[model samples]
Target: MEQGEFALSDREFNRVKARVYKEAGIALSEAKRTLVVSRLGKLIRTLRLNSFDDYLDHLERQGTPADAQDFINALTTNLTRFWREDHHFTHLETYVGQLMQRRPRGENGRPKLRIWSAGCSTGQEPYTIALHLLAAFPELKRWDFRILATDIDTNVVAKAASGTYPETELSGLSPQQMALFERAGGGQVRIPAAARELIAFKPLNLMNNPWPMRGPFDAVFCRNVAIYFDKPTQGELFARLGALIVPDGFLYIGHSENLGAGGGNFKLVGKTIYQARAQQKARDAA
Candidate 1:
């Protein structure tokens, strides 16, 4: 395993990434060749493989399940930032505040709310959501709620579950956010108790056979996940997501995507954001 050589050619890279999209609906666009090269090609060289074709063949013949995971991991777009989409977190902060203030009391006096950060790369999105929640409800220390965070990349997911981030990822945070979710050491930041407790990361593949998890989520964050899928697949995936989101729950997509061709089960609430269909609200109301 060398350190700087890449066995995968552009054509081979596209072929493998194409299979990823075909298998999982995660589009690996042309613009990301450099990313693949930078992220996975290093791994190819490290594996001491001289050709991408040989790498594939070795993976097919001698690669373990974990090795297969590494293969897929190399193909994913893990280019995430803290507060990557500021609006979603702002929207979450606003909505959750409203939800808490408007929360109906059960016999026991508690605010019950649930949020999911689907396709939560590494862990930034869910942790960001947690920061917002904690900031908005300083008393959330007393509440029983959690953020369900999941992604298909085992390595990143594992890293996220550990709640550690490199220094660069913390650059986008406000000083307040920095204090709340980080330790100020040289060149590193560690996630704090608040953000760490609020999110639970697991391995998830959006396009896998029969989704890996089920949800009746009050809010589900599926941002930037459907950009690669074709119309039919997108539609089906959203329809499936619709089934999981609480009738009155919220659905958030990437700023660039539209659920228009997918389905109208959600009505626009914000730019690229939608609330579950009215019928769902009606049922919840009843």
Candidate 2:
């Protein structure tokens, strides 16, 4: 990438970009060298460096786990909001209601509905799920629900787990839900203790071999994330997720993506959503 005669050679740029995609499923297009260089320029300047070569030398030799974290954090886009995909919440409500009705019991009497918000970024998504459940079903207090929120970026995971967000981030939330958020000193809004209690945030690299967590999730939300991976990587990812999700369980993906856009492990269940096959969730339970 050439900018005012200061260019990043193919090898140099690829070295950085490859490291990012390897760590996170995100691939940097050739068009994004400017951003890559611009972001990394801070690290260079912070280290008192003048050339990209020196930065590379440092990254290759002296970059610690902390550098890797900064590298991924800067490169990854963790923007998510409460009910960003509103339809998913509606679907979840309907699904959970049915589960509750079919069993004909209070929250405590019914089997737990396990959910995983993979690629949960900054924690909004999973908390949104919890709040939706709490608001829609007051009896949810009696039920045991677990929402696992995971991301490859530990920094974002920590922020998410803190359950704190800026006031402006509440714009997308409903007034009723917003009422549950409280502004702490310094203008930070914290997710209600109930909602925070519903989630378990952890660091998980989706591309890492031997996925650290296994699940029989009643539903899985893996939206807007696979779009960054190559087709093969995407396919493999869906396949792995398919195995973890229970049969007949729902799978929510990004609005812009489709089932098997990378490979076929799910059947179209809704608008850009899929199911792990009813047989799977049911048979597995049996």
Candidate 3:
């Protein structure tokens, strides 16, 4: 186990994959061997372990909750940019307009709007949603509106909560958006408190049952997250998501992912967007 070269054998890779799947429900493929090796290499060096095997053993024996958290954080990929898929924002605007029209005003004379950004790595997606909500419906600023941004990785969740980023991270934003939503200084930019206040970032594991929040959200953005899950896992996860959204509520997935043949609870409305069929019917009946 030299500084430059760390060996992760097939046996080690398979073991790690099984552990990841059990803990996080993310199915790592054989192709991810290089990624696993590269990600864990630093942990090995930092612990001064002799090899990947030693690191694994250390994890097994002395692995507290914090150690487990670190392992998952290392293996999970958190690649994202602001408004990564622009079309979703357009659809969100339309959906928000319709929702506001239908939204009940009797709840203390202010309607509630809830959006969930599942697997919100580093917070960009939720922040993007917040900015869009403010831009599309400035009236919402006076109403009760909130976004829940969750990730299994505690590290990313903390970063997301910070609402601060280096200038390089602002590349995905347009000049107008950049001017409107962020305050730039000291070679860095931070989202204004108004936008940051709209989101709550927390750690969540999709595989865990009895989720804490009471949902029926207006929209859910779970993009690029289920790509790592196997088919059965994807089906179950989407079904749960469908349950959490209001009827006619929107579910926005990644450009490359889809709700396959078994997504019976929802109907395709736009590119990579699914509307809950039951929720829509319920809304109509009410």
Candidate 4:
């Protein structure tokens, strides 16, 4: 057990792959063998395990809940930044403006808006959504608006909940956007309370059935997440998301991802943007 010397046999790799797929719906291909080794090697050594088999045994037989979570955290890839795909937000502005004009106020005499940022890594996407909404629709302060930001990685969820990031991470943001952040000590910037208050960060696994939230959301940003799943899983996930969104509600995905067969309930409206079909609303009402 020298550093970087952990040998992962085919059997061991497949075992890891199967477990990850089963638990998270992430289909790890043969190309991911190197990734698995690199990501888990340190964890295996930290556990004082000499081989992948021993680590797998520990995970299956005697690992604590924390150990299981750490395994998923180690394997989960979270790469995100503010305005990673700028076009989505641009479309969102137009969509929301139209939605506000058409949708009636709630019983409380206030406009209600709910947007879900599924797979919100490190809080950037959700925060970006909040910032954009606040900047474009200043009246949202008087409305009932909330963003539900969820991710499978507890580590990232916790970081996101903190609403803090290195100043360097804000490089892409404009001065107007930068004004929304307060200077956190140690060269970090924290999201202003106005934007932070609009977001609720939680840990969620998309693979889990009967998702805990009752949605019917105005919009859903599940960007870049379904790319990790195989075709069937992707279809099922988008179908479920379709059921949760209101008719005419927007769904923004990653630029690289195509909804494919899963897109039956939505119609393409903009680049990587979709509108949940009005027929869906009729079906739900019926």
Instruction: Highest lDDT: give the candidate number.
Output: 4
User: Which candidate would rank higher by TM-score, 1 or 4?
Assistant: 4
Per-model CA lDDT versus the true structure: 0.77, 0.80, 0.87, 0.91
Candidate 1, after superposition: displacement of residue 113 in Å? Answer: 1.8
Better of 3 and 4 by lDDT: 4
Ranking of models by lDDT: 4, 3, 2, 1
Model 3, residue 26: C-alpha shift (Å): 1.2
Q: Give me the overall lDDT of model 4.
A: 0.91
Query: Model 4 compared with the native: what TM-score?
Result: 0.96
Candidate 3 ranges with C-alpha deviation above 4 Å:
279-286
lDDT of 2 by residue, 1-286 (tens): 4443335788888888777777787888987887777777777777787777777788779989888777777777777888898989999999889888765443566557689999999988998899888889988767777899999888889889888888888886678878877787687788889888889999888888888777778889999888777777888888788888776678898987765553344688678778777665455457
* Candidate 4 lDDT, 193-228, residue by residue in tens: 999999999999999999999987999999889989
Best by TM-score: 4
Candidate 2 vs candidate 3: the TM-score winner is: 3
lDDT of 1: 0.77
The superposed Cα distance between candidate 1 and the true structure at residue 237, in angstroms, equals 2.2
